[model samples]
Target chain A: MRISELSERSGLPVQTIKFYIREGLLPKGVNSAATRAEYDETHLERLRLIRALREAGDLPVAAIRRVITALEDPGIGLHDLFGTAAYAIGPRVEEPGDDPAWRAARREVDALLEELGWRVTEEAPARTVLAQAFVALRRLGFTPSPAALRPYAQAAAALAEHETGQLREDTTRAQALRMLAATVVYDQVLVALHRLAQEDASARRFGAS
Target chain B: MRISELSERSGLPVQTIKFYIREGLLPKGVNSAATRAEYDETHLERLRLIRALREAGDLPVAAIRRVITALEDPGIGLHDLFGTAAYAIGPRVEEPGDDPAWRAARREVDALLEELGWRVTEEAPARTVLAQAFVALRRLGFTPSPAALRPYAQAAAALAEHETGQLREDTTRAQALRMLAATVVYDQVLVALHRLAQEDASARRFGAS
Candidate 1:
């Protein structure tokens, strides 16, 4: 297909497709003439992945580039592929300063993880992310106890297990791409679901009419 | 207490505190002299809340302002106050255009919600948010089934129940503010925990060494 058809099929403007090619987000189409180029199914697939990551996962262009780079590496294992994509797109937590309160919060998070026996790396960004929430909660006069966070952790664990159960050892590139898309997009799904559940919980408690 | 003391107590820079006041996120202090103003415990508490919402919740200034405005309304019921803050600071979903794929995904999401019997408003932003994720996932070649989503919803409902259980009928202003802060900050907590759990799941499945 020509660039025009590619643009029409992808529902992206021709100028936007050209801009993506210019920005190295999409590979240049095969040159068919001096000014005309032909695109293929790969271009369409890539565009879909880019759109999903940008719109649903809310990943920045640079982060999407990192994920694409990881996906393109044929030698990368499934675990490493998922890890790279996750690290590229997951919410970031700024490193905490040496405040006693922040330190206490960090220790509490570490303790909670240990108590749960969750095998996350010591350098996992989620540790600091959890600690930051703890610090903020404590500042607002609610120090969330480990007991309080356990249900959330257990739920997360069960959900993660179910998600990973869908993965297979001998995955094709296309299948891997689909999984990668699911991995990022499902985060938004879980977030929305949690909010909806909160509304439901509130309705039950307060008598929604 | 002076502005500088408020800054010290809140641990926010003096300029940032002034900026917050200018932005109407924080109320102005009492005028004491030609160029100086005296702040009190209210200012300190507001500063803490603002910092938590900004840093932990990642809410923009305008959203924080809306939350603060809602919080300041003395006659607002607890449920209404929570709804206001949630609408103000929750992740926003862009309304979809009249695309068939989007409509299909939206219908599927509506069905899932109905099947779950979750009592959410028709206009809940989370509905659109969930539909968007479903659309993105489908574009990437994974149609998430309602059965697959049930466990996630159940987990979210249980967690929401535990969280709402912390609220009381005769809450103080401080407690309400704390709950508001919790409402925003715990979203980040759940996200981080989910990612950490994913890491653990990946490690177990792929044999992380």
Candidate 2:
């Protein structure tokens, strides 16, 4: 089909479609001339998946490219794909590790998490995220104290671990661990866990929870 | 006290304290001429809070600044202050009303939740995340197909909502309801529920069901 037909069917604008092509996100159809290109079902299907990961999964472009590449490779696990993407766009802003105060604050947060009896893992980008946040905020003139973060980080770490651990307790759907790894580790850490909190508050007396 | 003394007490480094003073993230302390700034417990408390928000909450500097400002305000509720920060960081990349694909994905995911007999919401930023992923990927070299996504989006929505609901149904975490809101949402959606499947699988294979 022509790009216009593809656009109408996909519900995306022609200009946007062109942007996708230019970004190298979309494959070019057989070209009869300089001005003409043909697209097929492969393009349509790929576009749909792109929309799904981008819109539903909240993946960034660079991350999305990595995910697509991984998905196409057939050898990579889904968990790895998600981990790369989750860390790719960067989480919040991180502080530079070169600074001593930032390092102190980072260590404090970790110590508190440990204090809470939650097993903290280095697997997720929590450390990276914290590091970058400091750097970004410092750039914007914000300083963090280890004292303020200790309890909060511990509490959050405990809660996050609790939430993640709930997976191990459920007695059904246990066989799907592989599928769950990518979906849960990435989604829960990146967005879903927080969403639960947001819903609670909106419903609270405050107005939106 | 000396910078090192303050560092020992506050658990921050002398250098970082200087950076904070320079960056204005921390207020300048009593100066011993132009050579030094003194910090006290108050500064330490403030710094701790800043780190917690940045690391555990993963809040952006701009958002963290707003939170700090609010935290310092006399009239704001403490609960509300934290709640608002969570909302500010939000789901997805957080630009509202700009991405069609994102919105559509949100609606689709919400619909998926509904189909799975779970209480679904329209306010989720998960959709936005998915949308951003699309835009991001399109910026790269791969355009995902809709057929590839429609089913997965639907399945994720259904599975997440259903799984979490089931987990909550059996437990009496009386506050699980509140737990759902005051924390991140996706964690429970993906993590807690996935645990159920894993648990059941473990039971079926490792022990007598």
Candidate 3:
């Protein structure tokens, strides 16, 4: 297929697709003439993956490139490849600042994760994000107890199980791309659903007819 | 207590506290002298709420003022006030674009919510958010079925239940502030936890020693 068809089918502009190819985010199509190149289903799939990461995951070009590079790396196994992609689609945290409150929150988050017996690594950016939320809550004079956090963790674990359970004997590249996209996009979906659910519960309890 | 004391307690600079006062996000302190005003616990609490909304909720000053206005309104019930604040905090989505994919995604999300029997309003910002995520997913060649979405909704509902359950007989002002802050911060926390759990699951399955 021509680049124009790829652009139309992917709903991306020809220039943007050209730019992606230029950025090495997509490979050049097989050259059929001086200026003409032929694209195929792989290009279409890659374009779809790129668009999903950019639009839904809000991942930067650099991160997308990293995930692509990892996808092409035959040395990395399935789990580690997924890990690389997960880390790339980041709520990537800066190092925890040297504030007593932050340190305290970090310790609390670590303790809770340990208590839950979840095997998240120290370097997982989500740990910093979780700690930061705790600090914010505490600043507002509400320290969420481990007991308070338990339900959230439980829900997270269950949702994670459901997400991973979807993976089957699919091709590695396709599965990784799908999983990567789902991880980022579903995070947004879950947030929206939670807010909607909260609104419903508030209406039921607080009388907003 | 003085403005400086409020600043010290809330960890906001004195100038920012004064700015909040000037912006009407906080009421003026009682005048005690020509050059000074007396502050109290209410001021401290308001400052805490302001900081939480700004730092954790990422709410703009305008939105913060809207929340503050709702908080001060005598007629709005607890639920409505919460709805106002929740709307103000926002994953406030733009209206869906005039694209077939987005419209289709919106219908799918609306149907899923109906199937789940949740009493969320049609105007809920989260509805748009959920639809947008679905569109993004579909753009990548995946449309999530309600079956795939059910666990996420279940988790969201359970977490919402836990959050609302915490609102037992606290003063209206304090409870509303706490809930608003939680609604925003917890969304971030939940995203982080889900990612961490995914990493753990990936590690366990994919030979990531």
- The 10 consecutive residues of candidate 1 chain A with the worst lDDT sum are A172-181
Against the unseen true structure, what C-alpha lDDT does each candidate score?
A: 0.77, 0.48, 0.81
* lDDT over C-alpha atoms for residue A97 of model 2: 45
Q: How many clashes (backbone N, Cα, C below 3 Å) per candidate? A: 0, 76, 0
What stretches of model 3 exceed 4 Å from their correct place? A1-8, A12-40, A56-62, B18-37, B60-62
Docking class of 1: acceptable
Query: Against the hidden reference, what TM-scores do the models get?
Result: 0.72, 0.40, 0.87
Writing each residue's lDDT as its tens digit, candidate 2 over B55-173 gives: 44466666766765665665865345534555565554665675675565455545544543333245555545655554444443334345433333343443334434433334322
Best-fitting candidate, measured by lDDT? 3
Better of 1 and 2 by lDDT: 1
DockQ leader: 3
Model 1, stretches more than 4 Å misplaced?
A: A1-77, A94-108, A168-177, B1-76
Write candidate 1's Cα lDDT for B1-209 as tens digits.
Answer: 98888877887899999899889988898889988898988787788777766764578888888777878887765666667666655677787679887788888888998999988878887888888888777666676898877778878888888878877767655455556557667777877888888888877777457
Q: Output the lDDT of residue A58, model 1.
A: 79
Deviation from native of the Cα of residue A126 in model 1, angstroms: 3.0
lDDT string, candidate 3, A96-145, tens digits: 55988889888888998888877777888788888888887776677678
- Clash pairs of candidate 1? none
